[model samples]
Target: MWVRYLGFVILFGLPGALHAQPCGAPGLDGGYFVPLQETYSHEIEIIYACDSGRKPAVEGWWATSTCQNGVWSPEPQCIGEEDCLPPEIPNAKFNKKQNSWYNEGNTIRVTCDNGYELKNRDATAVCLNGTWTSVPVCEISNNTCGEPPQIPHAVIIGQKYQASFAADSKVRYKCEDGYSVEGAESKKSIFCISGSWSELPKCSRGTRQNTGHGSSVEVTTSAGSGTQTVGGGSGSSAGGTAGGHPTSTESGTQPGGGGRGSGDVVHGGPTITGSSTTSVSNDRNSKPAFIPVNECGVSPVIPNGVVVQTERMYLKYECNSYYTRVGPDTVVCTNDGRWSELPSCKEAFCVLDLAQYSGIGIRQTGKEYIKEGETKNVYCSYYDYVIFTCTQGRVTYTRCCEAYYHNYGGC
Candidate 1:
């Protein structure tokens, strides 16, 4: 039928022509369309579908979605990590209007008006990260995700003995004795989904290269969400969230990504913890010049840095909020400086989660990766708020408000 009226003119934008519709799936309301057979009715095929208990995040670069005419090519958006705000459920009546936020299967169709019927309610009341599940009583009885998320040094190849954990379960992630996941499909493993469990890949550890006078050391240990489990291995998520800065187990090779290091290697690498010395004198008499500290320590405050110090040993850097400076903004007075190689502020990738597109009235923010010409900003208040940049890493989209440019297909 003319490609279902060209996907209803690219989803109500009218005008005509323009077709692709990743199943017409929007967010917070559910997403996951599969109805088009009566002469292919009018067409609509969205996908993101979640809410039986929340837990359906799709954005590992877009999991899956394709349609090319009326738009809707690569729209995947149904993320979740436990975020149940707004009464979520006390009385209940969802498919609820969005202010921007909803995850996990995304459902809530309970009716307890007239005489109130639905004890162990199970028709739909998902949304798990923040909370909301089995919280449906309606004056009566009632009823009803994963279990393999413990990777700190990594280790779980064939360990079994579960008291509970069922639903396509899976587990085999490794990296314990010293941490490692340099490829090999990143060691791959972690499934249980729906009920929750997937999310754990990134062990990497072994990057201590100061080669100047040899003397650098750094160590970090974290485990505090009841003692860690569920990977929370922390940071690198990208797109679906977790864009840099949870760091700790870093040594360098790229492979994944994890920061922290560069305060002069943490303030102690001049024959091992001796630089921080201040005796500045460029040439007045030719003396007082001893400021080593660079194995990544001694001045590390990169949340959105600026750091600039010089007397002749030379040093200057910058990495404001939108961060993006990695190695050598300026550091001279040369003496074979490798000070263990320091320079990184990074952080800036896939942003925008108005609770997960609350109601879809229109919302977007950028970063989903950028480099080409640099530029990065993509916000919206209505619809079609595209404006992405970056060439080599690939991402090109544009609509109106182009503050910097969003990323990947949009508008």
Candidate 2:
């Protein structure tokens, strides 16, 4: 009976009976592999685990790598959180500890050096994850000044007395009656620097010459205002004779026309042209000013290129790769204030002339053409093999056909 029982166990339980060894897909280190001991007869799913300070490098449908046979994909790793590089603030300097790198929770201090003051509410930066907060700016004020100094025996001419002067303020002075400086004295004036006045000249007693008695007097001024001015003098008064300062072929109307209300003088073309005398009709009429070159309309805009600069009379066009400029690179301003020659950028193409070999029964398949850096395979009945390539708008060919077939053996 014992022998029979042992045989039955060996035959059915050992080799064929008990659960068969598993060959199902394996699971990751931190994943939930259901029925850890499941066999081929059943399927199992792997669900990954999550932890603090780390996240799935991949997720959603990307959770699984394909599995074949019994092998599993590489385990998905939870990457560490990232940190950002140090932030840079313009016009301001940032301070950090030596050998210190920006990481999570680190702070940076910044401040301005030049008479510059901060424009932002905060000057410190803190690192969070991979981003930084807003930064501050250092700015300088160009129009702030203090009090103007008083000089003895002199008073500012045509100037209202303001307790303090701002930057770029000017004051003119003339000696009290009968008092004057030595020979050849130019006008006496002083400009306000940062907070004080620039160097000034003294007025000493001297002789005043009147070149009026026999000489004729003529006074004239130029139209428009700004630094570009024309000041004229009479025989006895102290201004110099004003005449020529060339005008541009196209004179611009000051902004808002006749320049009555606005102070902007918009001129086109070169600097000088026309009559320098005060012809600009103190006209106060609100008519639009005339510019010479309405003729030079809008500049040409290339599809994939740009005009880097257009300051002078002539303009240049810039193009990118795979494109060629068909005309002149520079266009000069014409007499009418228009561009003399306009250029265009065209797409470069590689050309092939199979017509030259038409007698050999070789023909292009269609009316289409190939662009630069392209190639086409040709089927030549008389010659077996030929290949052609287009590069930089130039056509090149290679001959692979044998010597036995054609009149032109190779190209």
Candidate 3:
């Protein structure tokens, strides 16, 4: 009876073990599968899909895989020529926000920078298969300024007259003989500011008085009954006696500050004194006080980054594709006339390499590419899982298999 029972148990259990063969999760490239599970029953089928701009190698945008005796039939794969990545155009920008990839037949609008125009017939580009068409080229604009405005009594210095001048060109002028620039504060050169010439400086007929060596001379006069004093010395001397009072005058010339005073004169009628002191304080020829500029020079160069905006006191930057900024994007001009601390561009995305963690089992749907700072959960066994965070180009987390084996005995 015992022998008969043993034979029955072997026959029944052996057949059961042979039919219990289940297939492991299928690995799909360039795509993903739906209803992911650790194991698939025999003859079970699951749907699979490809990313944008790709199609199943077999046919169509989607296909199916069937589990057969611990193996998947006709391994599923997504195949495509390629995808249209963001284009790099000098002095040009896209009209819409950029994405990682563009599907076939996708269209995007492009715009040129200031003072530049698109060289292409259209401003739009279309993605055909894996190539881009109608991509724009930026070129300097043709807009120009005609001959600089003619000054009444001045001529352009070091520049010949021309029919037209390019944008941002500069033309300086000098006053003709016996003529000087009018306003105390005026720019001597005209600039092409934003495709237009700046206002021209006026040339006055009379020349400005030149006070040599920053010095000036004064004149004084006196009326009747008024005692007059003329001198360059501190102590006064009697020039003559008038109305019983002695008039004093000093002989030598004494320079006071930047001005010099001549002797005094007597006139008739009521007392009338005229004293004029002309100093070279407001003279344009005098050397002005040195003032330090509170602005920065050229912005600092950043790796894998571009300056979006630069001004006297501020600078802003943007990173290129697949790179992330590690610090503040905007920097301020410091008191030392230099830019503040700059930022750096680091790897911004990572690719999940399942082969590196092959011992661990993945339970949830996984993405091929993970952005920096993004988190995903992966499984090691039926009861063990780990959450991984992507930093720069790496994904880091404690291994779920190590914890599962130590805590749960086995899967």
Of the two candidates 2 and 3, the one with more favorable lDDT, higher being better, is 3
Write the candidate numbers in order of decreasing lDDT: 3, 2, 1
Report the C-alpha displacement of residue 312, candidate 3, in angstroms. 26
| Candidate 2 global CA lDDT score | 0.47
- Candidate achieving the largest lDDT: 3
Q: Write the per-residue lDDT of candidate 3 for residues 1-411, one digit (tens) a residue.
A: 999999998988788656767889988877899789988898899899998857665545678988888888767767565546567788788854333456556677888775566783357777666668768887766545677888787888888777666555678888776555533222277654334555556665431222344322222222123333222322211233243222213233223332233311111111212233212222233321211223465568899999886533345688988687777665655445555567899877888865566655654444566767665667767766766667757887656754434222232
Please give the distance, in angstroms, between residue 166's alpha carbon in candidate 3 and its true position after superposition.
Answer: 9.0
Worst lDDT window (10 residues) for model 3?
Answer: 263-272
Off by over 4 Å in 2: 1-295, 302-305, 351-387, 391-394, 400-411
> lDDT (CA) for every model shown?
0.40, 0.47, 0.58
Residue 116 of candidate 2: its Cα lDDT?
Answer: 47
Best by TM-score: 3
lDDT of 1 by residue, 1-411 (tens): 999999876778854434433233333344344332222212344334554544344323223444445344455445454555434344345465453555443546666532233563344555554556665555411100334656667767785755335432456777654445532222556543223443455565543333233232222212111110011022211122221312223222212113233211221111101122112112222321223435324554555667664322335567775566665454432234334234677664434333343343335432244543344444456434444555444455455543222221123
State the TM-score for model 2. 0.23
